[model samples]
Target: MYLLSKALIFPPVTEADDDGLLAIGGDLSVERLILAYNSGIFPWFNQGEPIIWYSPSQRMVLFPNELKISKSMRQIIRKGTFSITFNRHFKEVISNCKQMYRPGQGGTWITDEMEQAYIELHKKGIAKSVEVWQNNSLVGGLYGIDLGHVFCGESMFSKVSNASKMAFIYLVQKLEKENYKLIDCQVYNNHLASLGAKEISRDSFINYLNKV
Candidate 1:
């Protein structure tokens, strides 16, 4: 693994391990974080662990045109069961994401430092959030980096049964209307697969980021 220094540089994605861990020991400065996303790399490490960068050989992504909304989700959206807003409550959304429990995960990868870093990114308009509300109360939301034509999704959380899905669907429809090219999911999971997110070659994903 590469040990990053003051220089904001990263080893090639090809150098990543079988599990997609590319490098370690980089600080989460704004400059480094921006550069990382632009180059198809992202940091994912639990608290007490040195910041770890990854560029998986297979990247999970959702092209706006391919977003899948099931009948149940469509019905929920049409009913306006939840209200959606953009960049309205980023800190709250991320903080909730940090506290959310994930299956097979012992703790959050959104460390305190990571939270502060992304919060700063949000202030700069590089990071954005989608909030889902019910009965005037915040229920679910998601946060990610916005690369103009592509959104690099970091994490999401749900307090209700379909709150997170509502946030995601709303975000996808909005992005589609805005002519976005893709949503970078970072990794594959059944949750995303059901939404039509699929894996693509890292090289192909990088090329898309470069072009858009």
Candidate 2:
């Protein structure tokens, strides 16, 4: 893998390792982050590790039209059990994502530096947050980078059952209305697959990104 330097650049995605680890040791500057997302690359490193960039051979993505909402989730949505808002309390949303415990994970990848960098991106209108509220409390939410027609989803958190799912559903619907073509899930997991996210060849994903 390439080792980054002061230069704000990345190796070609084609050069990434089999697991998609392209490079390491870059600062999360706003310029670099923007370039990275635009090029279909993103940083996903654990705390205490050098920033690692990846561009998988297979990309997990959700086309707006392919979103799946189960009957129960639809019932909950129809009941208006949760209220959704966009770009509100982005810091809070990301912080919660950082702290929320994962079922089999011991720590979060959203380190303080990453949080601050993304927050700055938010301020510049390149990042966004979707907040899910129940009884006026921020029970669930998610954050991501908005690349015009493509959204690179970063992380999500839920404090109540199906709260995060609700946030995701609402976000997908909203993006559909805005004619967004894709939501980049970065990697595959059963949770996202259930929501209609599918794996596409990385080259295909890059083609989509190039169009946007």
Off by over 4 Å in 2: none
TM-score of each: 0.98, 0.99
Q: List, in order, the clash count of every candidate structure.
A: 0, 0
lDDT tens digits, residue span 1-212, model 1: 78888788999988999888899987899999999999999999989888899989999999999999999988988898999899999999999999999989989989999999999999999999999999999999999999999999999999999999988988998999999989999999999999999999999999999986
- Against the reference, the lDDT scores of all candidates come to 0.94, 0.95
Highest lDDT, which number?
2
In TM-score terms, candidate 1 sits at 0.98
C-alpha displacement of 188 in model 1, angstroms?
Answer: 0.7
**What is the alpha-carbon lDDT of model 2 when measured against the actual structure?**
0.95
